[model samples]
Target: MANLFLIVLAHVTVTAVVMLLWLARTYMKLKGELQVLKNSVQKNDQYLAGLSSSARAADSRLAFIDEQLKGLSAKLSAFQQNEQSANPYNAIIQKIRHGASVEELMRDCSLCRDEAVLLMRLHGSGPG
Candidate 1:
């Protein structure tokens, strides 16, 4: 009876030691993986800091470009308005320069296609 008890005790002790050894190895592997994760996190933090500042600078440049586009749009609109405003007087000036018969020009009073054609010819011919 005594010998059987001792044998059982020995078996339990050996099993416990094996379990402890496996748990210790698993703990070491997990600790190494945790260190690797910590290193990656640190590197990401530095990259983000640089990226954030560059993004701010890009936002500022975009604002300036937007302002320039708006100014260009306003100038284009004003130029169009001026062209329309000057059309009527410009047509009369062109007619006079054309030397279209004064009688015909006077009769039309409104001055018309004949004067414009004559004007283009006069301007295009030069000093005639």
Candidate 2:
């Protein structure tokens, strides 16, 4: 009877030891998985931070480019106005306003007589 009791005790002890080893292994696996998750989250956060910085820098550069384009556009607009003022037709029209004759306009601006006559009529003070 004592031997049978000892045998049952030994069986329970072995079963308990097996259950403890299985629980410890499960705990270690869960801890390893948690560490991996933590590392992944950390890496993602760093990547997001870098992206945010890059986006800010890109936005700043785009704003600078936009300002440069505006300045260039202003310069281009002024140059176009200056070019319009420099047109020979504008000078010829002024001369017509000051009462230059059709014959003089035709000679100075290389206009046909018909064109010169039109300009003289449009801009000249009176028929001549």
What C-alpha lDDT do the candidate models reach, one value each?
A: 0.74, 0.89
Clashing pairs in 1: none
Model 2 residue pairs with clashes: none
Q: Give the 10-residue window scoring lowest on summed lDDT in candidate 2.
A: 119-128
lDDT of predicted model 1: 0.74
Write candidate 2's Cα lDDT for 7-113 as tens digits.
99999999999999999999999999999999999999999999999999999999999999999999999998897778857888888887788888888889898
lDDT (Cα, tens digit) per residue for candidate 1, span 1-128: 99999999999999999999999999999999999999999999999989999999999999999999999999999987897686755654555566645454546555465664565455534222
TM-score of 2: 0.60
Q: Count the backbone clashes (under 3 Å) in each candidate.
A: 0, 0
Deviation in angstroms for 17 in model 1? 1.7
Q: State residue 28's C-alpha deviation in candidate 2, in Å.
A: 0.8
Output the number of the TM-score-best candidate.
1
